[model samples]
Target: MAKDYQGEEILVVRRSLFDELGEFQGINADVDAYLPSLLNPENNFFMDRGAAEDDPSHKQLIPYCIFRVKDDQGTRYLHYTRGKSGGESRLHAQVSIGIGGHINPVDQREDHLGFDTYMAGVEREIDEELNIEGGHTNKIVALLNDDSNTVGQVHLGVVHMIDLENDDVAANEDAIANLAFTTLEELRGELYDRLETWTRCCVDVIEEL
Candidate 1:
């Protein structure tokens, strides 16, 4: 049977309003104060992923979540992966440092306020993609974009950094693999070229991660 996308309706904004992603911002509580004016309610609509991805006139908001895993003393490394079996084929096993998907309407409700819908989507995607074994703290890190590629042109990533206090996070599905906690130096070296466009673009804002 074909995979049921469950009527996915991704929220998106104009590609131009961001302007070099405003040099990429890693926001905390202040994201709420800044987001309302950025999102045009009319431009934000739900459509099939296939069509939504090809339209460059708009940029979809995908919450890109990357968790930092640690154990006893301090930070170990950052978590990342690539889509594998059962996962979306378009990713084609390419490396993706962040874990998130489109903000669907089901991820929203009347109770959602400010960037809540996007944050809700972020939470939903992380749960579906990874298995966290212990305590963790999540914070919205940055708004990332790349008009440099076809896929990048159509999507804008809001980076979320999750600092996991345990060493137990793992990919729970065959659709995802190569789960690892790699250092920033390694990411800048060997794995740099392997990253998906949005990952490379968002790297600057998440330097502390």
Candidate 2:
């Protein structure tokens, strides 16, 4: 049992079919048992736990994105931070996506019921990076485990339309380089390859909305 940085007890819930069905409407059964099947390498629907744990390169934090699409123009924008793309040159660049990070020791509490720890991580990350006061209520569009890829766990969050035009909702310069909007078409065409499973899941949710 891996202890959280804050010396808190951590629980690793096995992937289950019930968890999957619970994410969507309708369809009820003993779904909890099926979570492992979805994560199996042979199925490839999601990543296997072995791969996620074996990889040493991945930072253990769960990353999330907060994206929005304009009602009139239908253009979507993602928030991201600027970081060093480790390579020979050690060059730094900007990435387009919203804020999210790993689960803190405070997040893995028994008192915090109903809400998932991953959701709590996203909420904390958004406030830290964007300096905005909000929460993870009904904003989560999809959840994904990225064991198949180099990046670790990821969750996609879709916030409902709000007055983003207000200048007060600005991103922290210390955390992010810039924030801007982009179209879904642009995301699919230019940015799709760079996206993680959570990004794809968010697209699915956006399609329905």
Q: Which lDDT values do the candidates have, in the order given?
A: 0.65, 0.42
Q: List the residue pairs that clash in candidate 2.
A: 16-32, 16-35, 17-31, 17-32, 17-35, 18-31, 18-32, 79-97, 79-98, 80-97
Model 2 error, position 109 (Å): 5.2
lDDT (Cα, 0-100) at 82 in candidate 2: 54
Cα lDDT tens digits for candidate 1, 100-166:
7778878775544236666677788888988889887888655665666566667766667788777
Q: Which candidate is the best by TM-score?
A: 1
**Candidate 1: which stretches are off by over 4 Å?**
1-7, 16-34, 39-43, 71-74, 84-88, 111-114
Q: Poorest 10 consecutive residues of model 2 by lDDT?
A: 85-94
Candidate 1 clashing pairs, residues 3+ apart or interchain: 26-141, 84-175
CA shift at 29, candidate 2, in angstroms? 16
How many clashing pairs per prediction, in order? Answer: 2, 10
Q: After the best TM-score superposition of candidate 2, give how far the Cα of residue 160 lies from its true spot, in angstroms.
A: 9.7
lDDT for position 44 in model 2: 25
lDDT of 1 at 131: 86
TM-score of each: 0.79, 0.51
TM-score of 2: 0.51
